[model samples]
Target chain A: MAVKAGGFKRRSGASSDIPSSSMADIAFLLLIFFMVTTVFRREKKREIDWVSAEATRKIDEKRKNILHLWIDNVGQVWINDQAIADEDIARVVRPIYAQNREIVIAVRGDRDVPYSKINTITKQLQAAGAVRVTFATRLEQRLQRPRR
Target chain B: MPILSRKQRVSDEIPTASMADIAFLLLVFFLTTTVFNEEKGLPIVLPEEKEEQEVSAKNILFLIVQPDGSVTVRRGESEQEQIVAYRQVEGILRQELAANENLIAAIKTDPSAAYRHMINVLDEVKKAGAERISLQMVGE
Candidate 1:
């Protein structure tokens, strides 16, 4: 009878200590959840030299509200990973602008792209009534000489 | 010899007491290493279609960007144009803006000019704190 009582007390005592064995399982579950829900940029990156500017600012708009318009040196315009014709810009942007009135167009043009190509895009954006625009550029810091 | 035998009698099962610690360490490592690529640019608002306003030429300060990356400054109501490098634009624009608070900085880029030239002039114009800015093609 004493042996039976001792066994019961040992079992109870073992359970009284929190089950830390499952801690790893819970941590793994959270890690898997984050890995599954993480959203990465889906668009294919285009190869083009980015222009740098001293006046570049971090766009304060939300991710969804901003649209990227990439103009390559060959004068190809890409939007949402689709190659778009210059003439059809207004047609493409109009419905999008209608759906979201707060959309901002970010022009990501290659440094060597002709200004004429950019002008055409701006005109198309105007016709579509998507007026708010941003010229995406790298931030340039002026190099100062070290004091002697 | 008996102690050696006793030492071998210890638990043969693998210890997992620090499994949680290892997992948590990995989690913290990934969390600290994840870098978000934030969007950045020079923001400008283009006028809506048919919303163009007619302002007097006296309030306009034209900065013409040629195909060779030369910037020419043409003030309002003055035929005299000043040729300057892109670096000198900020100072000239600052002086003009200070002289007239209502002055507008207009950027005219030639069709053949590289986009960087226009951006450089635009950067200078923005650096000078010009509120009213217009971007136009040279032929237009």
Candidate 2:
């Protein structure tokens, strides 16, 4: 009887490992969720080359109030990644102007492009009757060197 | 019977000792593949064409841009137009701007000029705290 009691105690005390085989599956599922939701925002930043400016105010307006136009380093004009000719800028801008009278046409050009391309774009915007057109510039140090 | 039970239990466990390693490998793969947001630009409005009144050259500052990225600033109150470097425009315009708050800097950029230089001049003009700016494209 004593021996049987001891055997029963030892049997009850035996340790068993917790199951963790599903850990890889859980982690893989989470990784897939993140991968699908990840957005690089590639349209604006790729090859932009924004020129740095000083004492420039922020773009205070809401995203809905502005139309973003980007010019690549190679002089290719794009609106939301759609290629549009310089001459057709007005056609694209006109209707948006009609819908929202307070719309601002913001021109973002690459630092390496020529002024001629910018001129053509702005002129087209004007012809499209866009009253508010602005150039986009990156920020730089505001304080100047002290006077001698 | 004992041997068969032992073999069955070992096969049922699924060999999960390497599970943590596989999870870490997948996590690392995702971490390396993430994309982050970048910086945006500061917006400024161009002057209205309908409000284009004929102001004499003496009333405005002219920043002439050449194809080689050189800048020439013409002051509002003075008739003299001097070829200035990009760095000098900021201090020069700032002093002149302090004296007169209503000064306007007109950018007469040659179409052949590099676009980066025009933006540089615009930056300096804004740096000087001038409120009114006009851009006119010159030379096709």
Clash number by candidate, in order:
0, 2
- lDDT by candidate, in order shown: 0.90, 0.75
**B54 Cα displacement, candidate 2 (Å):** 1.8
On a 0 to 100 scale, what is the lDDT of residue B78 in model 2?
75
lDDT of 2 at A91: 91
Q: How does model 2 score on DockQ?
A: 0.35
Measured as a fraction from 0 to 1, the native contacts recovered by model 1 come to: 0.83
In model 1, the runs with Cα more than 4 Å from the true position are A1-37, A145-148, B1-16, B25-29
Clash pairs for candidate 1:
none
Error of 1 at A31 (Å): 3.5
lDDT of 1 at A48: 88
TM-scores for the candidates: 0.82, 0.67
